[model samples]
Target: MFCLVLHSHLPWLANHGRWPVGEEWLYQSWAATYLPVTAVLRRLAAEGRTRLLTLGVTPVLAAQLDDPHCLNGMHHWLGNWQLRAHEAAGMPSASHRDLGAREHRASAAALDVFETRWRHGGSAVLRELIDAETIELLGGPLAHPFQPLLDPRLRAFSLSEGLADAEARWGHTPAGIWAPECGYTPGMEIGYAAAGVSHFMVDGPALRGDTTAGRPVWDSDVVAFGRDLEVSYRVWSPKTGYPGHAAYRDFHTYDHDTGLKPARVTGRTVPSEKKAPYDPELAAVAVDQHVADFVDTVRRRLRSESERIGGPALVVAAFDTELFGHWWHEGPQWLEQVLRALPEAGIEIGTLADARARGYVGAPVELQDSSWGSGKDWRVWAGDQVQDLVQLNAEVVQTALDTIDKDRDANHHGFEGDPELRKRVHDQMLRETLLTVSSDWAFMVSKDSAAGYARDRAHKHAHALREIADAVASGRDEVARRLADGWNAADGLFPALDARRLPVRSAETAAFAGSTQ
Candidate 1:
């Protein structure tokens, strides 16, 4: 069995910056990757493909995809793409004009798809695929926080609320999750089972490279499927990958005037000025060749593993969804072709869910703290370079949680003091708290890509949490309410996030759900 998992995510960018960093990241990935990649899935589904892959769209990213602000912005972005193509058409160079004409047609087609299928937001489109059983949607924490370092209650609350958020959008709760950062702690499977999550993805090293089957974690029913890096790295690696082929469009080179990539990757070390024009025909030929190679790779891995394991073995390849159109211009095309070619090569493809359902599982194993990051450990998120963020996360989460405890204490006393106001304030504080611990910040800082922006976002959320917590602690209800309202106007995504719904006592307001169920 072969399971391909695409973990789709972007931090909250709705009310954040626009030009170089924040919302631009969202729009580019949505336009270049999400729009086209999902279209591929939709097209394949029309041809009657079932369980094609497991797609994990984090709750935070899902919220943005369905946000009215992002919807309007994406519509405008598509229209602007058309305008830019026209600009390229009027350029002095003939080759540039050809690129313009090509982009214009592509943009026009995208605009039509956007206006028709995406006007209502991504939830509808994804829900259609889910209802059709074309893909298994994996849910994650509400804000993509690093789970291993997160507070236990906060982790549980985030997971439950994240699943609830997905249920609200698609009318189906996910039984599997692509745990944020693929981050896991030793005893976390108990929480997974509690949240009704039966399976999740982990790095290959987490299973010590014996990743031929899903392994039950620590005697629990919850299963951990390790990515088969031997197969996965063939599609994306440092020294070699299909995306680096000379015929594929160069993701790094851009025609700045028209904001389009017009050159093929002539060579790895070739300068931008020396690159050749992108030819779609040549790219198509390369995709075919790469698809054949990948099929052979998977076939050999399966044959070897089946012999070694004494039975059929599962090969799981997991990657970021943005790798396709956003980071690799010919990625969507290659993906479509590969999906078609794999089955024709006598390969059986299904999702992680199908693997478990069919008993493609191994004996229980006690897993260690692991991530798909540097050294397959927590260094990217918890390294010495990011010590400040690690400390800040601890302080922010503790403060937000303490405020909730203080609120509970007030209710314990005679002065219950505006139940609705207290709930609203605590909920917003928790919201900011979740944003503060997002793994993106530490990741960016560690990788030195937009490090300043990452630090600013983390500090900004931490400041908001502190300000609101201080207001509530000082007995300033009106000030706290104002801050909560203002923050909600900016950071609000999950409408069902409530302080009462957190892992709180049943007598407080309502019973904590999925904790004991």
Candidate 2:
């Protein structure tokens, strides 16, 4: 029985309004991917099937999922989809000329089924399935920071907070975490062990020198499970995956002329939608073939491994949760069918935790410092184009620490007097720090998708923190009040951010930094 762990995550996309970039991308994904995936699990569980799949919804994304604003936006978006479909179906031109119009109508009706069945507080339906042991819920750090590059103290604080948030929502802390982007280093195992995580997922390359998954990789006290590259790459490889086939829906070719998605996955930029509406039936046939091939591959691999090593063999297939329903269009259907089909084929479908329970052993090996980014290095955050932001990040982080230390030294205080004031400073500091450290800035800089926006945001938040630190250090209470008020007006989510909770930079911490600040 092989464990198939799918680590699903997106950075929190709320309130930082950037179209084609931030919060909207989040809501679209929630409607297209997260919600639908959960619904599929719910349906499978309803049929008296208990399949194990690990879903790591990051704390930031989780907060947005349950946030009232995002929920309302999702409701509106689904309803709009329904309205648009009906309106298109009713048009005489669409009815008379577009043979695909009827399909659109059917698609609309299916979406209606989705919206009505799962939109309003309906995720709890899947939550109930989780409660019933139908799925294993995984979680990760608050804000999804790239852990390896983060300060150890900040990493510990963020991961601990994430665990607490998961338990608050799901009623149990996850035994494992889907480290943001499978971002891991040898030293991070201490933080994971400290945070009570028994295991975490890693990309195959991080474990095996080559990414051909043949064995488990252990990083000190924690167990590292490698993603089965063949199975995972089949779905979404860097250059070509199942979604790149000519018959599937094209992600990038939306008809800007009509604001309707008419482009098909014609493969290699040939624009297949100009030919015809992608036949969902054909897509379903493709899904079946892919599933059969995957199942056979897993069975053969496991059988060969058992013959060689004399143990119950395991294969872990990992993927981004967004690939389903969002990119492939038929991906959710494929996933549902695959989940249902795997068991009958004698391949076990279970979460990483379950595999650990079955006693999968990690070999004594040291893991490379890596992430699932380009070049599998910290380039995504510390790349050349983003060098300025990196420097600003270091500067702002130092400023925050320096201010805290100075204030503490003078009065031996964290945040005194007003609870709300202290909270604001702490929350603002965290917010600025997170915004500064986002991998998106580096990704955008590398990808050149609104590089200016990423740069501006990083510097803006850095300046905000630096100014706040200066205000506090100078005993300029009025300036501090003004800066706090400005931040309050801009980023007001953590209204009760008690700055008092921020620990002072102790001599030990200072000793660790070697007079840097």
Candidate 3:
């Protein structure tokens, strides 16, 4: 069996900012990736394709998608896209004008889809796919924090709350998670088992023992599926990948006049101005060839692994969901073609959940700490490049927990304080703390992709957390309330979050000691 997993995630950006980053990032991904990808899934579902694949949509991204503010913003952004296309049509270059016309039509279609289907929010759209059993939805923590670096109490709290949020939206709790960056520590399986997570993903090196099949972790029944890099990298990588094909639209090169891509990749080292004009027809041909090649690769790998294991084997290929239409313009069409072609080629396709139920299990193994980042270690997040951000996160988490504990204690004393007011303050503190710990800012800074922007975002959240904590501690109830309300209105993503669920370290420590048997 072949299980394809796509991890879809973006940090909480709604009401934070927009433009070259922020909510614009969400809108571009929605119009270019989410809408098109889901359209493909819906078509397959209409033809009764069950267990198509496994998709992980993080709680933070889910909250933003479902937010009315984001929905309205996305609607406006699509209109802007249409307007840009119209402006492009009058460009002096014929190719540029054609590109604009094509984009204009695409924007129109997306606008229609959003107004008719997605106007309700992303949950409504995803829920339809889940209800149809077209895809197995995987949930992750409220924010995509690097779980291994988090305090154990926070880890448990985040996972539990995240799964609960998924259930509230989709009516089913995910049995698996695409762990943030596939980051794992040795003892995480205990937490997974406790949270009712039956399976999760990891980098191939984490299994050190074998990468052919899902291995039961340590002594827990929870299974760990390792991504097959050999297969996944064929579609996307830093060096060679299908999107870099000379015939495909150049992702980096955009026309200055209309801000639309009008050239093909042309050559690996070719300058933007010298690149050949994009021919969608040529790109279509490349897509067909790549689809056939991918199917054959999967077939060959599955056959070889099955023989080696003395039985049928499973090959899991995973990738970031945004890589599809967002990065590679023709990626959605290629994906739809691949999904349709694989079944007819006698290759069985199913979700990770389906693969597990079919008994694709191996002996238990102790996995090493790992992630899918550079060196397959924690360097991308905990490395020297971003040590300052790491320190900020540590301080923010501790301060938020301290404030929550202080409020809990005051409530226990039956103080004259309004319970509702205290809860709001605690909730806002937790929100800012989670935003501060998001793995995105550290990653962006470490990669140097948007270091300044990333650093500013991380500090912004941390500052909010500190101010709320200080206000609460200083007995300035009115000041604290105002700060909490303002931040809540700006950065709030998870409306279902209950700050009371966060674990108090002192109580959790005693509970851990009691459960050691």
Residue pairs in steric clash, candidate 2? 422-498, 422-499, 423-497, 423-498, 423-499
* lDDT by residue for model 3 (1-517), tens: 8989999999888866786778888998998899999999999999988989999999988887888989999999999889889998877877768988888899999999999999988898999999999999999998999988877777888899999999998888999998999999888999999999999999877887256789999999999999887788888875788999999989888888767778999999999999999898999999999999999999998888889889988888999999998899898999999999999999999988888899888889888889999889999999999899878887787777777777777657555654533388888888888889999998998899878888988999999999989989887889999999999888777877888777667766545433421
Error of 1 at 305 (Å): 0.5
Q: Which TM-score value belongs to model 1?
A: 0.96
lDDT for residue 292 in candidate 1, whole number 0-100? 88
Off by over 4 Å in 1: 412-422, 505-517
Candidate 1 residue pairs in backbone clash:
none
For each candidate, give its TM-score against the true structure. 0.96, 0.88, 0.95
lDDT of 2 by residue, 1-517 (tens): 6676766665545666647677768766766787677778878887888746877777776666666667677777666655555555555664222533744664565566555664554345446866888878787877677777666656676787778777777777887888887888777887688789878888777875332233333545577777877767867888877777676766676533333455457557474445455555676777888777767777887787667667676777788788887777778888888887778887777777777777776465678788878887778777787777667766666677667656655664445653323435546676667656766666778778778877776777777787887788879867876886787566544333334545556565555444322
In candidate 1 the C-alpha lDDT for residue 222 amounts to 94
Q: After superposition, how far is residue 175 of candidate 2 from its true place, in Å?
A: 1.9
Shift of residue 415 alpha carbon in model 2, Å: 15
| Per-residue accuracy of model 1 over 1-517 as CA lDDT, tens digit each | 9989999999999879988898889989998899999999999999999999999999999999999999999999889999999999999899989999999999999898889999989999999999999999999889999998877788889999999999999999999999988999987898899999999999999999999999999989999999999999999975689899999999889898888889999899999989999999999999889988999999999999999999999999999999999999888988999899999989999999999999899999899999999889999999999999988998888788778887767756445454444378888999999999999999999999999999999999999999999999999989999999999998878878977766753442222222222
List all candidate RMSDs to the true structure: 3.9, 3.6, 3.1
